[model samples]
Target: MTRLHTLFLIGMLALLISTPTFALTGRVINQTLNRPEPDIEVSYILHETGDVTVVRDTTDSKGQFILDVPSDPGAEPPPMLFARYNGIDYPGNPAPAGDTVDIPVFETTESDTAISLSSHHILLDAQAGTATYIFIVHNHGDHTYLTGGDHGHGLEIPLPDGVTDFIRAPQGVHLHGTLLVDPRPIIPGNSQTFFTFSIPPSNRIAQRITYPTAGMDLLVQPTDTPVSTTVLRDLGDVTLGTNVFRRFGAEQLAPGTQIDIALSSPETASNLQTPIWIAATSMVVVAILVIYMRTLKTVPNRRTILLEQIADLDERYESGELSEDDYKNRRNALKAEVIDLSDSN
Candidate 1:
């Protein structure tokens, strides 16, 4: 080939090599119960340490998704791309038991791996008073840090429908003191954050609170799971009553009156039961002492003679006048005398 032709060929080759290449593209669809869950945010993560380059995506109206990720130029083989749809940690429940996708290992090459996540919902409705109900959100998963800032994991709870004119405590953030939402990032293994707040009384029936929609990318080990904890109340409930600054307690609660009571930890529970137990124990000891004192009157009062006999036995034994066996016999005789004197009562 001529030199000019060769140069033109080289330029064409460089252009082809420099062109941007797409790593992988796909969408995360929630196929649970043959339906799609919108508003479920997706995240792309690095498996180790859950350090992630987050790409937030929302499902279409039909639950379809398409992601365009660029190839990593520095990677030798390029890292794999996984789709974490909604909360399902895997993709395509194709198996009979809903098999999830395996999170791929990091590499220098582009890999098309899809991740799916799932969730279960339960309904809990209860009444609250002026006191805030604190929920300490402990992030047991990876990325163990409180991202909720100063408010902690605050969730803005809207007043129930058709209900208003209620008192609010810590009202600046939202209608409710939202900083106490659960599942706040704790050290995946050893650390956690504490959150507390008071829940105000609301007459509304359709109250809503803004809760956390996503969590940190922490690898949950085989033994890792959510552990429930009992809430320990540091103070008794303050109730409005006729007496000044007085309220009814467990001991004085009236029949059929409703009250809020929190479960105590083992140590606190033991302390609570101690007072009654000690009182009963003292009564038992007193009863035993009284019985022993009553039995004393039935014994004879021969103190004078008993002391004389015991003194004589001790003298003989100490003087080396009594053999081992003889000393024992004399001691027994003296003991019998003392017993007989008591019977004379």
Candidate 2:
């Protein structure tokens, strides 16, 4: 072969060998409505509509889920992905954080990534009497610097006093007691969202109360790195009226998570309503007493006689210093008159 032909053939072979390979890539994440929940399920799904397509997935266990999609070279540009996991529909698997692609794979590493949340601490409001709080440590995908394994997102909350009664938490679910302000985990590069929970009584309002007087400390794990930020909130005042308290913050949660709270005061017990039978009996007793008092036509005569008797006994006891026995006998006679008056009614 000529030297030029040999060189040309070698270059072509190198080009064919270096071409990038494409594969199916995706992940399933499971999650629940509650935090710190355990045993969550992550389901994956996909759907197509006409020429367009969408894909999505979710979990009952602490909101964990995954999405795996295979790319087809036969499809036109911008393939579609869809999913309907546990009744939630995603026209297309929303890209995580900063990237976007309808197809599961185009060109990327780590095809599947799992995401979930962990509950760290809860806060309470002493003055406003509302329990306001935040769930810390929600995990997302790996960033360039903070690899998905590194630093994730965290939430902070300032709880007001007197709102929730008992809270139930399951694994992977963090159940907040009464909440003043419930904030969603601040996804990096996303707009902030909040969940507003008020104490039962609408009139009882809690406003800006000073944040943690001692302040809060953020300690990152794997290393003892401490994050410092002073937490504060406006305290609210109570008005005269009915107050509502929460029973369960998150209805659905993972299993096996512990639920509890440290309180400023024990929750007030609910009062039993007055029964109809008891109310009617009391009303009849009151009516009888009222009628007896009104019908006492000889009240004046009775009052005069009792007064005279009492006066006579007092004079006798003081004058001769009547014997103790005689004085006691006469006093008893006078006391009977008063007792009679009460009994007549």
Candidate 3:
């Protein structure tokens, strides 16, 4: 090669080294119509520790768009992508930069026939005093299910014998022995909602799956009292970080399938509803809490530790190291610990 050509190639290499770029690329597709959705608005959310950044764009003629995301060394895994259609937000699977993701959206239907629980993870924990049930649900449907009724009762969750506090829900209103989130339309894909209600402290808790759930998993956190379920297939112990949990699994659960979960004996414990964390499995938050819980038991500065952990948890959530579901669950758990610690003092 000529010396002049070598010098030109070196300059191009220098330019590439001096300038760095991270591109988030993807497309929007309509699942119902089986066509690329053009002119739809899309947003790429960057979750960084203690911070969040949103980048917005419109899909082109071919239903594609690209956004330049700044590289963050400390950002959490799976930054989120969203496409809004028909007044609903459809989320693409979270992915890091330099990955292509498809945002799947469906046409809206007032009927609920296609709506079923793709997966349900029930977490029965003795937090504060009440027995709380957290349901993480997904809608495996080709169309968005619009909830319609006189009261918009598209989806209804019945309260067991005794329950209190609406806790948290994606959408709906509660009525008499039933928690109804009216117009809380079920969208296609994972994590449709995370909701909880507290029942009076008791040894046996009856949890009814109100939807025709395809598969379900029950996880009970470690407690002084033993926990077990006769209905679900015993999956044995599953360890998350240092915390060990007794897990059970179920499948083809028809609507109104009731499973009795036996828990600690009845007592009046403080009712603390933690609408914080929501996922069935989150290793990062689990690892973070495992360390935090250790400090809680071992250190004398329990309050100080909790306070610091709470702040740190917020940073992780904001920074994108934690999902909203896991963030909420762990945040509430930590705050509840703080409250209990204060009550003792």
Candidate 4:
């Protein structure tokens, strides 16, 4: 071989060996066992553009893992690592390449001891006759809640009335008769689950929420949707997605509390054509005040409006939601008008 050719080949081999390899380092700590865990599988997931890459490695005797990930030119490496134990995912802190982090895992349990409800939200689309139920459940205990040891009978999800068919549900959960059985473990922190169902055409629905809620909200879409409930306080209207909804909320409700809601539609076609009744549940108090005052000043023959105001006036009048002086002043005005009309004018 020529001297120059041999020298060139040797130089290329030296450069290849000099380049350093890229790797990620992390450790898995078993909180339940109160020590480091060995022989645990750790995964590193990276998504670049439309392509996804996952690298896996097992922990050593010291509970440490080193994943040798192939570095792409001008690409960024992911900083988070994940470890799964007892069907719950444990995520480590974000660390750059060549840095170390620790992931914590726990043992599994079937007991529902520390399980609590953080928030329960129900979204009802009146126009579509659909009801969607959402729940944010938290496990405050140190161990993960697993249904494995219970012989597939651990968690119970009560079905809302008028549930005809389901549109969406979480994975690892199946419907058994009227109730749903969820086998998925409720991991140590907050976990959210939701289900949507189609109901027959109706204006009323009742559901028995079986969890003790810290905060619960009931929302109905298309602000015009007539929704009223005795269990919750109207919190006015809140915009969600591209539409507006009537919002109701309550705090610290006991388990197995039933929530009943009803809707009303105008009987006549003229009432339907009457521009969307801005008198939603959120504005009921404001509407009552305006109606009582408008009737005192307008024509006296409009007894229908006066009767309507009295019919709709319930606990809201004395419920402290409206100012006491406001209603009293309107009452005086009505008396003055009655006296003037009764005179010879």
**lDDT per prediction?**
0.29, 0.31, 0.61, 0.61
97 Cα displacement, candidate 2 (Å):
22
lDDT of 2 at 82: 34
What is the total number of backbone clashes in candidate 1?
25
Q: What lDDT does model 1 reach?
A: 0.29
Q: Which segments of candidate 4 are over 4 A away from where they belong?
A: 1-22, 70-80, 149-151, 200-202, 241-243, 266-345
Candidate 2 or 1, higher TM-score: 1
- Tens-place lDDT per residue, model 3, 173-242, is 4563456454555666533344455655565667677778877766666534466676798788876554
TM-score of each: 0.21, 0.20, 0.61, 0.66
lDDT of 2 by residue, 55-169 (tens): 3343334333444543443421223333333222222333433343331111112212222223222222222222333322233433211212112222323243344432321
Per-residue CA lDDT of model 4 for 178-215, tens digit only, reads 78666666666665556666644456667776666788
Better of 1 and 3 by lDDT: 3
**Alpha-carbon lDDT of model 3:** 0.61
Q: What's the TM for model 2?
A: 0.20
Candidate no. 4 TM-score:
0.66
